[model samples]
Target: MTETNDTANLIQEAEYFYQKIFAAPVPRPILEKYIAANRKKMPRPDERIRNLVLKKADIEAVEMAWRFKSPRNVLTKKIHILIYLAETTPENFSLFFNTKNKRFSSFIVLAGHFVRSMGKFLKGKFLLKRYNLV
Candidate 1:
């Protein structure tokens, strides 16, 4: 039983490391847009669009996380998240585009790509410096 638990932890740790190597934590609301879309029991018309409905859906349950949580998500929003997975090294991409003041108006919504990437970058840099790795 202990070994089984250890194996589970190892798997989770590997995934966590993979995610760090990929990008950052996704926001809660963005993940829900996906779950509500997939689950057969559709939220009510009014409940569907409410941010709170999406927020309550567990963010970590978003599948293929390394795909959706990486720099690739920022590039194409993950229609091809896996196609770019093996190449997701930070040196090969950037979330900090030169669009400091950029803005767009759209009726559509995108998932957690942005916040996840940015948060990952910031956290990685902080951890590196904190440990004198930099």
Candidate 2:
């Protein structure tokens, strides 16, 4: 019973983070502009249009807010990426939330992929340190 409850809590936490990261409401004007621009390029399916609009909105929001330079923003971005991966590819991330069949191998695989994905950000930090710029 305890294990089942733990799994439920883990799932809830994952969902909470997913919503927090991806559920921001993009302004209607931005959405309409993206839709119009995309339509001019080519008449694609609605799903594809939606994806492109959201991507653009996310980029614009980050840029407008000037979030790229802040350490806290970087950390939040990392967490968002991790949560997105876990939600999209549950097979790779399920072990952490599955209490009954927890395995070290699965954890290692997930960690490796995460580190690889984060390499660019980490490299920047390392370069700064190497040149005594940090």
Candidate 3:
């Protein structure tokens, strides 16, 4: 029984680590947009064109429009999010980009985990002292 429990715990830990390596956390505001779109049943592509013909399109000045969310959604939202984050917060672009590339992203996440574990052992001191970043 104890061995079974240990194996289950290990499997859960591995699953969590896998998600941490591949997927990045979606922030609240962007998530809200998807939720709202889902709730409102936003107009379909054809309807959007009709609205344009009548000169009543939402955000007429903008080219790309928002989309409704569904269970089988594509990577469009993910790319949009990455682009938005990269533009707004250029410093963290590498982290955003890594989430797109499997190999590089895995390395970045593992390095982050290693640094965090080391920080705890070093009494919350600098994770990388050689950088001299206070």
TM-score for each of the candidates: 0.22, 0.24, 0.20
Weakest ten-residue segment in model 2 by summed lDDT: 57-66
Pairs that collide in candidate 2 are none
**Which of the two, 1 or 2, has more lDDT?**
2
Task: Give the winner by TM-score.
Answer: 2
Per residue, candidate 3 scores C-alpha lDDT tens digits across 1-134 of: 35454334333322332233335454444444433442244222232222332342222111211222132222233334334533455555565455454887788978997876554435323321322212
Clashes of 1: 0
Candidate with the greatest lDDT versus the true structure = 2
Q: Which stretches of candidate 3 lie over 4 Å from their true place?
A: 24-134
**3-106 per-residue lDDT for model 2 (tens digits):** 45433433333334344445634333433343343335333333321232343323223322333455444324434444445444544354346656548887
Off by over 4 Å in 2: 1-69, 74-96, 120-134
Query: If both were scored by TM-score, which would come out higher, candidate 1 or candidate 2?
Result: 2
Ranking by lDDT: 2, 3, 1
The lDDT of model 3 is 0.36
Looking at model 2, residue 56 earns an lDDT score of 35
Model 1: per-residue lDDT, tens digit, 71-132? 34221232233224333434444442333543442212233656665565555445434433
